[model samples]
Target: MGGTDDNSNVRSVKMVFVTVGTTCFDALVEAVDTQEVKEELLKKGYTHLLIQMGRGSYFPKKSAGGSGCLAVNYFTFSSSIADNLKSASLVISHAGSGSIFETLRLGKPLIVVVNEDLMDNHQSELAEELAERKHLFCAYPQTLRSTIVIMNVDALLPYPPADAKPVAKLINRFLGFPDD
Candidate 1:
């Protein structure tokens, strides 16, 4: 409940960017909007929480303003999220291949939250594999709070750029094709 405009003491703002891509993942949107989550993020030294809600029916009731030290804001969509991704210290994204690779290519620490409601949940397969390699952490909506509590950003390995052979090999491996 403490709100202030003075950020002079803050050297550089660390933002936690959450994107759900082009689909609705309300569970994700709602999960990060909670007071408990915000407090946890603040404890981790993050100053902002920005959510790209995409086509979700649920919008967080929280206002787009600074709540204590953490400024929470969200939007429905954007033409290009590259700038947002670039600015983030950490990214919590839906388990979409595009989102996954882009954030990884930026060499940012990422946590991919799998939406378990989808019928053909390929997201889990990709997220789990990436997590297994320690490139990023994977979580479900139910486990996300706990994941945030325990996440050590320094422990994540940088994901190789897409043009790199390792990425090609990873994709091939994910698709069940023999490494060539």
Candidate 2:
């Protein structure tokens, strides 16, 4: 990690979370487990890698090979979702709507790693649309290293307000502050 050490009292080492959702995404996890990916992430100052693998056949090499910095969870439910998102500075997840909305709602930098194997190629379109809108970035296992190298939290733009003018006006009117 290229950040200030804990003893230095400067910046804290960050956490990167990867989730494969309910189904297996062995390929994505495996790619992220490669030595090249590991070294790049470490150099980027991410001290911890938290992976939620679900039923995936492969576990992260870093954790399996006895590196204390990487943690892998084989399964998780919605109860675990919020804490996981809140703890991570960046989230790399299967391109599912639940994870996408949740990550965006939390304003976390997200990388939507599309699993073309599982979704009958449906995730590709969704990933493309989201990426086009600048809501997130997407990558396949083969390009994982380069994508992570270019990962930028600053590239995320502000989300538009959820309520339209009429909706806001309705709420205010209901509160007896109408037509102001």
Candidate 3:
């Protein structure tokens, strides 16, 4: 189940997608420093995108690209790229619950950088637990360079866990909506 897929679009490049979740982390100013990480990833042949999903953040009109990396910042979720999680061969992200769940569900190899000073450090704690369990890769901003080197998107794939179904019935369980 763990092997490179040449036919898979993921093997073709390295990509980073960020999800800030529903809350804002002022400490995310640290991400401006991602320029350094971007340089290193490009040297290793990867493209980077930074999506900002916070109240006061703004998506850049221009793309963030340099040193062979391409990055984009968005203030809100773009439906066009929602499936980017599923299609990306590798994902670099913030340690948000929603982000982690979606990445794991898609079976993509992930390098999660936590949002500092938010939620009693819960995100960091969660990232650590998951990393120890072999569920995902985790790192802090300073160590990002070394972490990226160890990643092989091919090593993460074909998730073995059966997709979970709901444990309880819906409140309006009987009606199936028509396709519009």
Candidate 4:
């Protein structure tokens, strides 16, 4: 993703939240903190990037040779992330099912980055399923920045709106209610 292009897109993206859950996801954080990625995001007009840097050892402020553009960005670990979820224009996250479900509940466009190093590639399964359903996009940390740039958030759309009729009917049937 080359830096310097559209102004409207920049104006459109006001806040982007990148979360690695409560685990160490240095790779994903590092990808976003890369000079190239920083420049690309700046060019795209995404000024506010709040990173939930979990247990990662790398600190953006202490990183060497990083552009000052990232200096003003927000970085912290917060367990109660509902506020961030509510405010973010887009969410880029680890492919944890909890995060996926909650983000979808908020109706935000999510990009899932699956960590293959973890035990059992189950998150990959969930990520792939959601990606196929057009509910989210998936990428490895290695390709995260490019994936973000290449995929237009507007086109990706929010998760399909929730429908409760089927669930309600099933619950009522289980309780011995007459079939409608």
Among the numbered candidates, top TM-score falls to 1
Tens digit of lDDT per residue, candidate 2, span 60-123? 5445222334443334334466888899988888876667767877888888888867636756
User: Which sections of candidate 1 miss by over 4 Å?
Assistant: 1-8, 63-67, 162-180
The alpha-carbon root-mean-square deviation between model 4 and the true structure, to one decimal in Å, is 8.6
Q: State every prediction's TM-score relative to the real structure.
A: 0.84, 0.75, 0.64, 0.74
Reference-based TM-score, model 4: 0.74
In candidate 1 the C-alpha lDDT for residue 114 amounts to 98
Clash totals for all candidate models: 0, 0, 1, 2
Model 3 agreement with the true structure over 95-160: per-residue lDDT tens digits:
765577667877777878876656567668768877876777888756777777776656554434
Off by over 4 Å in 4: 1-13, 62-76, 161-180
After TM-score superposition, the amount by which residue 23's alpha carbon in candidate 3 deviates from its true location, in angstroms, is: 1.9
Candidates 2 and 4: which is better by lDDT? 4
lDDT of 1: 0.87
Estimate, for each residue in 68-163, the C-alpha lDDT of model 1 and write its tens digit: 657878899999999999999999999987788889988999999999999878779989998998999999998898999999989998876755
Candidate order by decreasing lDDT: 1, 4, 2, 3
